[model samples]
Target chain A: EAGVTQSPTHLIKTRGQQVTLRCSPISGHTSVYWYQQALGLGLQFLLWYDEGEERNRGNFPPRFSGRQFPNYSSELNVNALELEDSALYLCASSIRDRGPEQYFGPGTRLTVT
Target chain B: AQSVTQLDSHVSVSEGTPVLLRCNYSSSYSPSLFWYVQHPNKGLQLLLKYTSAATLVKGINGFEAEFKKSETSFHLTKPSAHMSDAAEYFCVVTGERTGRRALTFGSGTRLQVQP
Candidate 1:
């Protein structure tokens, strides 16, 4: 089976611009998670969506928001982006009932200038 | 609250030598642990996980981890290090709070294998 897939593998934007990164979960998976892997910061959880509902979030700002589609895909939107927002954004998914072993995607690298 | 810590920022070993990546976790409840490996410019791959079913869990690529509840540790190990094993390894802990499950990741340990 195909693994999780992300779009626009790389994104470039300037300060104050808005960016949207997309992810498609693996088949039969119901939970999608977003994480920010910034240099020196490790992987920080951003958002968690389950069954099309926002289940949980991390310690990020309001500018970091995302939504899940009916198809179990997800989109992370960063508003008024700052240079520090540049990082590798990863998306992971797993069967909600099964445990926390998530399958990850290649991630979308966002570079804000 | 739950947290994970990777003891080593980097470790260098020779080929055919044993590999050890240390990880410690703190959780109020029984936690689910995982080891993920990330290659250069690649996505994170699951090396192993512990979910209370087995104290010692074996994963892909000859990697394994032992979950010691008393010590609050989940350390990854490999019998022999290969050149392809050079990558960044992350230890993660998942726990539930207020009915929501969240994961806490460690800073990661970079492994370097010498020929």
Candidate 2:
């Protein structure tokens, strides 16, 4: 089966610009999650979307927000990007009722220069 | 609060050798544990999970992990390592009791397989 898929494997944007990352979950999956992996750092949870609702979010600022569509795809938006915002953004999806062994995507490498 | 700690930042093992990656988690209630492997430029692949089921969970790529309640640990292990097994491994725990869907991840351990 097709696994989780992310768009724009690499993205480059100037500081203060905004960027949007997309993710398509595996077939029949209902939950989508966003995470950020900063340079030399571990993955930090960003947002969680399920069944067209923004279910939960991580410790990120309001500048980082996302939404899930009825089709189960999701988009993460980051406004006023800073150099510190540069990192690998990953998207994962899984069944809402299943345990949280989320299948992640290849991730989009965001570079804020 | 829920947190995961990977005991080692990195581990190197020769092909055909046994592989062990240690992970410890702290949760006030019964937590769901998982092990995920991420290859270079690839997404995280689910190795296995323990969610109030069998203590020993086996996953793809000949990988498995056992959840030990006493130790508050969920460590990944393989009988033998393969060159293709080289990747970054993460231990995750979810708040099953708290009814949280988000999974808390560890710092991750990089497994280096030497042929």
Candidate 3:
């Protein structure tokens, strides 16, 4: 089976611009999660969507939001982006009922100037 | 709350040598632990996971992790290192106690294998 897949492997945007990153979960997976891997910041959870509902989110600001579609694919949106928002955004998927183990995508690298 | 700490920021080993990546986790309740490896410009790959079923969990690519509940540790190990094993490894943790599915990841440890 195919693992999680992400789109727009690399993106370049300017400050104050909005960006959207996409992810498609593996077949039969119901949970989609978003994470930001920024330089010096390490990896931090951004959002979690399960069964098309927003289940949880991390310490990130409201500017970082996302949603999961009926097919379990997800899209992360960043509004009024700042230079600090430039980082590799990763999406992961897992079977909600199974456990917490997640499979990650190649990630979308966003560079904000 | 849940968190993970990777003891080493970087580790260098010679080919055919044993590999050890230390990880410590904190959770209010029983936790699900995982080891993920990422190659340069590649996605993260699951190395192993511990879910209270087995203390010793074996994963893909000859990697394994032993969960020590008393120590709150889940350390990944490989008997023999290969050049392909050079990558950044992350330790992750999540628990039902948090009532959230978001995972806490470590700072990550970069492994370097020398020929």
Worst 10 residues of 1 chain B by lDDT: B95-104
Candidate 2 residues lying further than 4 Å off, grouped into runs, are B97-99
Report how far off residue A106 is in candidate 3 (Å): 0.6
Compute the lDDT of residue A53 as modeled in candidate 3.
Answer: 94
Q: Model 1, range B37-105, lDDT digits (tens) per residue?
A: 999988899989898898999999999999998899999999999999999999999874444566789
Q: Give the clashing pairs for model 1.
A: none
lDDT of 3 by residue, A1-113 (tens): 89899999999999999999999999999999999999999889889999999988899999999898999899999999999998999999999878878999999999999
Candidate 1 residue B76 Cα shift, in angstroms, is 0.7
lDDT of 2 by residue, A1-113 (tens): 99999999999999999999999999999999999998676899888888988878788899998888889999999999999999999998989776666888999999999
DockQ of candidate 1 against the true complex: 0.77
DockQ comparison, 1 vs 3, better candidate: 3
Model 1 regions lying over 4 Å from their true place:
B96-98
Better of 2 and 3 by DockQ: 3
Per-residue lDDT tens digits for candidate 2, residues B1-115, read 9899999999999999999999999997778888988898777888888998899999988998989999998999999999999999999988865335788889999999998
Query: Which runs in model 3 stand beyond 4 Å of their true positions?
Result: none
Regarding lDDT, does 2 or 3 come out ahead?
3
**Global lDDT of each candidate:** 0.93, 0.90, 0.93
